[model samples]
Target: MAKQSTKNKLDTSALRPLLRYAKPHMWLFILSMVFAVITVATTLYAPILVGNAVDLIIAKGLVDFDGIINIIIKLSVTVTVTGIAQWLMSLCTNKITYCVVRDIRNDAFAKLQKLPLSYIDSHPHGDIISRIISDLEQVSDGLLMGFSQLFTGVCTIFGTLGFMLSINVKITLIVVILTPLSLFVARFIAKNTFKLFHQQSVARGDMTSLVEEMTGNQKVVTAFGYQEEAEEQFEEVNLKLQKVGLNATFFSSLTNPCTRFVNNLVYMAVGIVGALSVIKGVGFTVGNLSCFLTYANQYTKPFNEISGVITELQSAFASAKRVFEVIDETEEIPDSSNATVLTSVDGTLDVDNVSFSYVPDVKLIENFNLHVKSGQRTAIVGPTGCGKTTMINLLMRFYDTDSGEIRISGEPIKDCTRDSMRSMYGMVLQETWLKTGTIRENLCYGKPDASEEEMIAAAKSAHCHGFIKRLPKGYDTVISDSYSTISAGQKQLLCIARVMLSLPPMLILDEATSSIDTRTEILVQRAFEKMMQGRTSFIIAHRLSTIKNADTIIVMDSGHIVEQGSHDELMAKNGFYADLYNSQFAVT
Candidate 1:
């Protein structure tokens, strides 16, 4: 993992991640654009028909009622058909937008799975969740409403301008003058809004983190009587979010009204100019003047639409930038490009001069060396934070050693595929994490293809069958939400059963009996001893008495192995192991 100071900042320029989703729907986009152009052309033609109808009635005084009726019928059909076409275009736009958003969300989540644990530790869970949910939703809104409309509106503006110039070049020039001024105002508002929108997204992430923290730790707050403190902290985050939101809203608010004002000014100028041109006998007929006015009104529609879409575009761009930042993060502990799968294993393990640290410039394990013969039982004991758990992590290949190598069966773990390597070992942690399922399902977690008899036998070996059999539904009882119905010790036993079912050649027990009472711990220890027979095992324990009978007991301190031997040899030396034993279990 990179150092905190060097962690990549959110790069707004890394928005190409969205293209992976957009590419698949290019054909849909093309179809929608075709329909949109057709709709815009039909809409622009309607104004000309209306203007000609007025000229026939008022200027030439040639009513021709039947001809006027026929023109009206054709205009109605065109309007209806074009309206249906626009609706079809909207449906296509929505389909493409939804598929793109779905792909992005899926890719981002898959990337998270491959990310190192260190990244997760540094970043907030709620903040990550917010990006996946709220940020992606913002991107979807932009693609569906903003991008689609901007495409159609731009086409409409140019097409309308072309028709207006064809009807009367003088009026077209007057309308075209407002376009640059409107664009200038839009650019100015967009610059400020983008900055404010970025700030708002950050503030919102902070708020989400605060809320998640408070909710998850509510029990701690009540127990420690820190309700007021939690509330004050929440209020501070809320205030910051409010300030950022107000700033974003304030800038985005200016875009519409300013553009509309410019448009209204242009409309007034066109009216005045048209009246003068008529009185001066400049060959401006009633039809030409009416069409020019209609075209003038049509020109402002795109400007207004663009101004509105600018705000959404800024937000969408910000969301795209955030989502891409996550996708672009380098996987700190990536699998080796040439790594091969480990299909067979005998479980002999070796750690040779291994060194590691979670943070740079701080060593947690220094020149750590250990060797476990296949099918031997070994226990690691040390003071808190003496790198006992770190040793297990290195053995499991969760984090690569900063120096030296770790090997299984004489093969360096780094060269082995992660899945095939992990499949060879069964790990039981201090806390048992059970999904919402029946007892049978939890038991089969490790070896999903285990037969019923195999599951029952494993359960018996782990000392879990007795309790499970007492339940009304036995193995069929459904467990809900973290398996709250089971006792902590029962959950631990079930996890042990899960490991037993897998029957891997290697096993790791990291404080696996910490949650059970002393009597239950002794029972579990007996089951563990039986299970460890004929399998290489590494056990990390806080309770020294539980591991007293191990074949080898290694004592660690300050990232080095201070002492190692059988129980009697270590006690006879009266060194760090002796001191820890006397202090913890000596009994004054």
Candidate 2:
């Protein structure tokens, strides 16, 4: 049984990755700070002006209309100017945030390119995509909008407190008495909100993976009449996601209302206290009381803003933790630090005493040895689960051998850079994956620098040119959906064409023609003959006739090579290869 993963926890260390992205926007952040200062200063001045107006009316026993108009005009102008400044600052902040997000996406993609095949095998594609899309968006929201509001709120809160105390310390003290209680509630909501958001992200990834699987295997689902089963599975995941999402929403939604309620209670307390002070002849005027009340009301604005920001902060931090998990993962098969470029290679290959296992206790290959001279063709014939594909995987450095070494051109593959090692071989797997794009684009993927003429020649060599030419746009024809326009044979041929375009010195064919019809197989086999000439090749074939002309053949059983030699020699021995050949050809 698989070990259960540990519960998701907030990783404060994840914040360090954000600093690299923020460095470029330091100047803009500083400007936003300046704008925040101006905004806060303008906001705090309003209560003081009202207080002064009240004093003037009480002292003179008459309303000074001119004085009041002047104060109103000055306050309005200050507010307008400060609002413009804040807008300018917000524009710059948003630009920086989006740019950082774009960089993060690019970085993730680049890192994926460098990762070994084993990493991809261990992780699902949809989960990786969720980190790049949904997770990054959450982080961006926090950095762009949440950070600005948080900073402004903190500044406003402290700034308002300072001015309030200056006017009347007694009233200020009463209003702020319940702040700690509000903060405690905010903290509780934030903690639970983070947990819920993390669960939501995981559930979303699971749903994405299920949807991708169902879409990609719709034919199998329909053929097996398993639509109800699939729908049930999907609903199970979707309902789980809904539960987590609702919990996250509920926790986040509680922040504002709870903060507002506490703030109102504090305001009422302040009113009661101020009225008692006036009744007791504490020299509190009506204007003084009114100004203090206004300031008290202003005090809750920052708390509300902060509560909202806390919810966003929790989500952002959760997303950042996920992204950092990817970034922090040590690549299991990284290139050597001092590895050199292999500009050209001759395809001499050797595998000495190789052993491997995906799991710790089960061995896939043990004491395996193989050799192919430059320009030689070798075939590995095996029953299912006999480790033939694993041999190919080791040769391509998809997974490093657990013991012993693999060498190409007499150099250990581990010593060479992965880029250079991969550059020397052309591979075609059992399942052909074609991207949604033009024929030319897919063909050129293996050799981006290949000219248009070279692409056409490769297509012809793969025997796909005739079908491609029949399409509406020939090489430029677009394949929107993988299933609608292309048959399995066509996709396999396209894979062949793509490999041919690469023109590598070594080739590995892993049931490359398995999905094609017999006629198309003959065409593909002929093309393979042309492409494999004078190149080291490894053929893992299911059809016995396909490898009849191979220079050498090896039969494998239970992860061990059991028979070796030419096809006739193996037949003469009447051993495992002979049995396999007889069993396969008996019906034919």
Candidate 3:
């Protein structure tokens, strides 16, 4: 849902959003341009002074110490002022570029929070990371360099044209004629290289995705002895990246030398024209002829620079487009204008005639109905792809149902504020996620003001306190993906302790004890019994030992509840439920 197919071309639409982002910094941008103009205006004087120095030498021999000294002083002062202005200009440009990038990054990340779960499920993690990090860095850094050159190059072009025309209109016409050739060369090369850069960008994302996937599943790769296969896969993606990168850079690199060649031709024309004018005596002083020659060189230099700016700007535009693509995706369905805020959840829930399908043609759940009394343990057991997880997702409102309504405390959940609804539930999923932080900090994430006593008590109950206290820094030790000083089972125990610390009115424990050893599982189950009291709890477990004593057991198959009862009731019936139980335990 997030990825969109775009034609291979330079789309100016990406720049519109960038211009909008820049609007807040409009005055700052203008001030930067002012400094740029000052720099270029001062630089334009050096050539004129050089021409005057030449005139002085010819008019008063080469021994005019006073005239030479004065010209040298003026040249030095001009260069100093120009350098100061250039420095100021760079400061303002960097400020604008980075600020704009910061806003873009913020919006892109915020967009991810609002995007549908399906969008995240469908896209690769590394591709999304590339768009957020690498692509944005490219856009900002490239624009910084490209805009700096463009601002100065443009001013130099117009400023040089004015100086040349003032010196001699006929000589100025020489540049006006040859300048078109340089622009033509630039446009032709840019057109070819723009698409190549875009292709290279896509290839870079592909390479990142492959590497991330391989790294994340390293254990599986090694166990399967897939090293050679993984390396071959990487080489395929790396080769594609190399090919496109070479082509894009190859074409982009051609612009400078090609434009310079045309510029050199313009310079030769000016030299010839000035010498002819000097010979023909068209009332042009040697100083004026020399000034015209210098102006011609200055004029042609911006053309070469502008060409390079065009190449860099294309990469910036391509990255900007990728970033804007994410920002522009349709946001999650908004809460109601006057949404109800759930409070004091009673744990009562009713699923009425609910139907859902990930794909329109393949219905996963149809006309599903269920109800659980307040403060009861409801267990859902099902085979893979039997919509057990989907039901949990609906209960959490991570996804909306296609039809019918889900209610909590006899009020429709759709009308409740999602934040308030979610705040009522404490979830410990099968997958454990812990950001880089101390154990105490991770425990207090859902309840920032939790007391130290509450944290230690919950850790003790969840059978995690013993292991945590053994760590180097105890509760203060920092943990991360790379710096995991704990085992997987220990990590799961921490997750349970986190939920125990918060102590919400409702709970979701999806295979929460799967990682713990058999001995640890028994202790955790005692903690769960205490935690589940006076609160609604939903548990999805593959091991029947944990849920055998649940207040209600629901068996789901083919998107429908096939059998549901207490352990004794289902076993007495001796139907599908008895058969399923016997299959798991009746080993030959």
Output the number of the TM-score-best candidate.
Answer: 3
Cα distance off (Å), candidate 3, residue 30:
1.1
For all candidates, what are the clash counts?
Answer: 0, 0, 0
Candidate 1 vs candidate 3: the TM-score winner is: 3
RMSD (CA, angstroms), candidate 2 = 3.3
The weakest ten consecutive residues by lDDT in model 1 span 3-12
Cα distance off (Å), candidate 3, residue 17: 0.6
Please give, for residues 532-562, the per-residue lDDT of candidate 1 as tens digits. Answer: 9999998888888888888899999989999
Which of the predicted structures, 2 or 3, would earn the higher TM-score when compared with the native? 3
* Leading candidate by lDDT: 3
lDDT of 2 by residue, 1-588 (tens): 121112233435555677787788788778878888787887778777777677668565588889888888887887797788778768777877888788878888777876767778889888888887888988898777675787688888888898878867888887788765677777678766777888888888888888888888899999999999999999999999999999999989998888888888888987888888878877886667777788787787788878888788777778877777776666666677888677877888888999898878987799998888898899999999999998988888888899999989988999998878888999999988878889899999888899989999999888899999999988898874455477887888899999999989999999999988988788888989988999999999988889999988989988899988999999999998999989986874
Candidate 1: TM-score?
0.92
Residue 265 displacement in candidate 2 (angstroms): 1.5
- Quote the positional error of residue 421 for candidate 3 in Å: 0.6
- List candidate 1 segments past 4 Å from native: 1-15, 59-64, 332-338, 436-439, 465-484, 586-588
